[model samples]
Target: MNNKLIRQAQEALIVLGYLSGTADGKFDKSTQDAVLRFRRAEGLKRTNIISQPLMPYFEAATLKKLQTNLKTLGYANGVTGKLDKATIAAIKTYQKNNKLRQSGEYSHVLLAKTNRAAREREQARNRRAPVSVQNNIGTSSRSNDVVISSRNIPSQSNSSKASAMPNLNNRTVQENEIMRSEPNTAIQGKMRILKGSNGQVTGCKISTITISSDWCTSGNNKEGSQCNVLYKNGRVLSVRCR
Candidate 1:
């Protein structure tokens, strides 16, 4: 058995709150018990060995837990199991704040550090007591009086009508042209339109990734009509009707 693999597994288990001892690169009984528990939780066959096939599962589980912790700590906005762009950004921010290397990658060491920080924060919160605020405003016996003077306010109906009219001048047209010339709109315009088997406009297929009608509906395009969607690097940037 590779001691390095065992040590990595132990570190993952520790971050996942399955083990308590140090990861000393030894397949000890404690490590075996932790591995068993993890396996059970993952619904994998009962095994104490950290094989090559099982390593990826451990890494994925550890990453999910780390993402959850970061979300709870306000470092991440969502708990995505994969290391997508948002996850990378969150990891980079967290590393920068903690004075660690901003590699934007996951490792057992990073997971352990994040887990420790979360535990410390939880303990500190538990140690604090709830504070109660008391309102002690005394009643005043002074008479409060107010007087209002009415003044004749002039309203020009011509000015109100002019203000309510829509502006169709050159500046408004220029602003609309500039908005249409944006890079996102240009990209969407350039995307190849896709159709379903029935010849109705369904969605788009950029490279190997497919943006289906469900994604369009999720973006408030409930009709799933002819829509332009901007997608890049496994993320949907924008969705709008053509």
Candidate 2:
């Protein structure tokens, strides 16, 4: 299958909670395993191969699509894309109401129904919404030109505070400015990107690879270098490195 198809499958699987990784258009083992799990859950013959007939199902149920459709169908609270506890609860409630199995799995049928229902709801909403004619070009009516819907606008009180939200770009710029502004120190440091089993960045390093839990210097590279693993969390676990 093409990378596009693989990416789509990965996206669908992710929303369905079968996979965890960015869909970077690669047919990796994680994507294959996700496909297998989905197939098994759906009572289809489980296989690593991305069969032709399964493409549509895989392309369905993307996180954004799921949130949009679920919200439109009144099954979800909002379109946050992330399937947190609230989202899972909403999915369960939807499944119960629809008389479908309450496995909380995002099936092809669920996705298809969601898309259709969301479309219908959008059409109905549009029909009910007020429309306005544009004022003449270069006219002074620009300030008054705006569209308002009759629908209730949800409050953002529950959302994160602006101050609490990280300004990533600003932080990066500030760091760069600081680095450039500061004099070079004698000490220097190097860092390596860490990957999960599926090769996605996990923001941590492999601590140990030996059969025993003891720390050893065996897995050093030819340059006589061993990784001094660091972690965001304090706990350490033994893991195999490829």
Candidate 3:
């Protein structure tokens, strides 16, 4: 699909709660479901029509429904209920799976994919995992997407090691100046860029992001040796160097 349409579809989905990444205008499954779910609930045909294909017949209500969903999902930050950045990020995550769009817009194909993934995710969650002692080490929720090895880790550490961990509490706060303001703003820690399983943490900008959990590395928006995520306080938390 065209980039603009893809972004529109993705934006519509994020406005609905079915996503968790920046809308970069790629039509993925997450976007697809956003369209379908909104349509079905509104008593409309559950099809991919959040685009030129659907036209005026399903445009207005669909957009409204999408916004409503986004608010319901906590992604819609503003009370205005407009499809903003938060909504777009949440939607972009869904599109990641279907391999469609990611430009933070709304479209047809993305709507379809989004709907399908949600249903599948629900089903999978409901299904019981096979009983086995085999290690199925899932990634950490806190470390963005980088997988750290807790395996064989010594539970007991000397005071020196504990003290070695960087303390972010002393960080210089510059709220008025505003850093990490843009979506896809790179995350950097002591070592490098922090990346999620998908790649790097690319999503909405939060007013406050405390580095409570220590990050040796970080995440960024582009491929580079130098960090893309520069801190106003001169601290590079972590950089997303691909």
Candidate 4:
């Protein structure tokens, strides 16, 4: 028997919530029951055997379901339907916070534990005082205070007030002019370019700040290239040849 194939099948089953324990590559009774459940769900032959051709089906289904669950639990931002770097990072963070093994991989145990945590948090929130009751209490307290009329209040002369207030419009225009005149000096020197798994230039890092691909416009930039980085809003915006 191919232990590797069995392990993969077990992991897929665990991710789909059919199994509850770790995938130990052993065809135990629990694994067999999980496989039987999965077969019934997919309308396949009611057998516990995981064939070589069934690997792709299991992988695709498991990844999509895992991504959906991770996103719903707030562990991931968006579901790209693929196991990308962001998804792995979210998984690792979730596992670390939950005191799990921190494997940064998907499993039924992780999902089940996270679901329970979410339910506990929701119950705790529901036990708190409602916002409407707090607002009513504040309103009741303020009702006993005296009301003041704007017409009875003293007012300053328009001429005096106009002279004291500075020309805010002109000041704003001057500040904008100064900002436009200033040179872009967020990144003074060259920084190292970074790439993704597809060998495309994604972003760069200077010192300690790591810029992401969304903030970078990599025009003819390559990985490991020392390029002049344009910075904006506390991030690297673009990379160009000096």
Candidate 5:
């Protein structure tokens, strides 16, 4: 099988919203989540393998998701899902980070970043051992490692928003963007703050990364987004939110 072709196919899934993770091309747990969600949404058997039968729908969805994210990050000037220069640039920047690749090609790094983006989200759920969640965390600015602690949940004394660290990526704050709070159910002294683009926790500045399980989340035009998390299944893959 042509790994390049397979990687391209996987990139289609990431761009179109069929999957949310690194486009690393290895098709790890996060990719599985996106596929299952797409399959379940399409009334097909949810399988791990991306086969020939499901290629068309997968491609369409991947393009859409890619367009959305690229646009959100100010990369895709075009609304269409076509891989224009703008979109490629956005993917390249993303590739440089979360996926952590030196090559410019859309090899495994892109696939991995798009797919594994949600894997780091477990930090929002698990409070006891914050390091547990960072194990598979990506290197994206937003993928900044979070350590959910029972003590860090939003409170009058700490909910000052500024009390939560600032997003040092120099990313302009969306004026209307509401800062989300970590769950109040955290245990005492458990670190429960979101990481920033600086790779440090300023205050619990919860960005969209807290929305899903990080790279574990997957999206598709048709099925929306899904996760690879074991959840109750004894697995730990997560999914991105749409």
Candidate 6:
């Protein structure tokens, strides 16, 4: 088979969450492992060898995996391989939820965001660990109970809104206060509060929030105007409120 086909298969495996490394057209160990995982997930024979018939399966599997991820992120998109209205609508809904543009187009960036959301949700659910017999003696049973919240349940919000996070690579923020609490580990770089057309902080970006040690020249970064406020500790957020 052509190396291009292998690269395509690699990209599909990536969309299905079976691969992590880049699709460099080389059938390396990571690519082989991803192929094995994809085959297992699709109920095919567990092998690293790519075949002609399996080519179509790669694309279908990618779409289905994306649909699964979208569902996990609280969108009710259908799992059809075709670019149906339902899937596009779900993409738009996801974009709106993440304060992104409602282009209704599938991109690797959007896939990444959905994957992160799914992983975060999975982590949150995992935090409610099963109760242990040893701890049952000293404390109330309710204290050890695993309570799952419905905060992540999907909603059918309007996807027509034109809200999006500013390109963080191109923009930066001026800060006002230094955070005292431990920062959210997931949140990194400089955080900026994004404002909507009405001048309200509709969303926020994880852009470079420059921190300076000197009191007199704190806002003197070469990137742009800087803020003296430090945000070492603050609430970790995916986006600000609407």
Expressed as tens digits, the lDDT of each residue in 55-114 for candidate 1 is: 888878988888876654555545658999978877887888788998999887888788
Candidate 3: misplaced stretches above 4 Å? 1-81, 130-242
**Residue pairs in candidate 4 whose N, alpha carbon or C atoms collide under 3 angstroms:** none
Stretch of 10 with least lDDT, candidate 4: 172-181
Candidate 6 clashing pairs? Answer: 190-209
RMSD of 6: 20.0
Each model's TM-score? Answer: 0.52, 0.30, 0.28, 0.39, 0.30, 0.47
Candidate 2 lDDT, 1-242, residue by residue in tens = 88877776776777567888687878888888888888897677878777568865554336557766665455553555566776677677667767788887765557756667667755653443111111111222334222222233222233536533233333211000001101122111222333334322223212121111121111221112334432111112222232
How far residue 75's Cα lies from its native spot in candidate 1, in Å, is: 1.1
Q: Candidate 1: how many backbone clashes?
A: 0
Residue 178 of candidate 1: its Cα lDDT?
A: 8
Off by over 4 Å in 5: 1-53, 66-79, 98-109, 118-242
Residue 61 deviation, candidate 6, in Å?
A: 1.4
Which portions of model 1 miss their true places by more than 4 Å?
133-242
Poorest lDDT segment (10 consecutive residues) of candidate 6:
210-219
Could you say which candidate leads in lDDT?
A: 1
Of 1 and 3, the candidate ranking higher by lDDT: 1
CA lDDT of each prediction against the hidden true structure: 0.56, 0.46, 0.42, 0.52, 0.41, 0.51
Candidate 6: residue 6 lDDT (0-100) = 87
Candidate 1: worst 10 consecutive residues by lDDT?
172-181
Write candidate 5's Cα lDDT for 59-104 as tens digits: 5555655555443332333446566665666666665555455344
lDDT, residue 206, candidate 2: 26
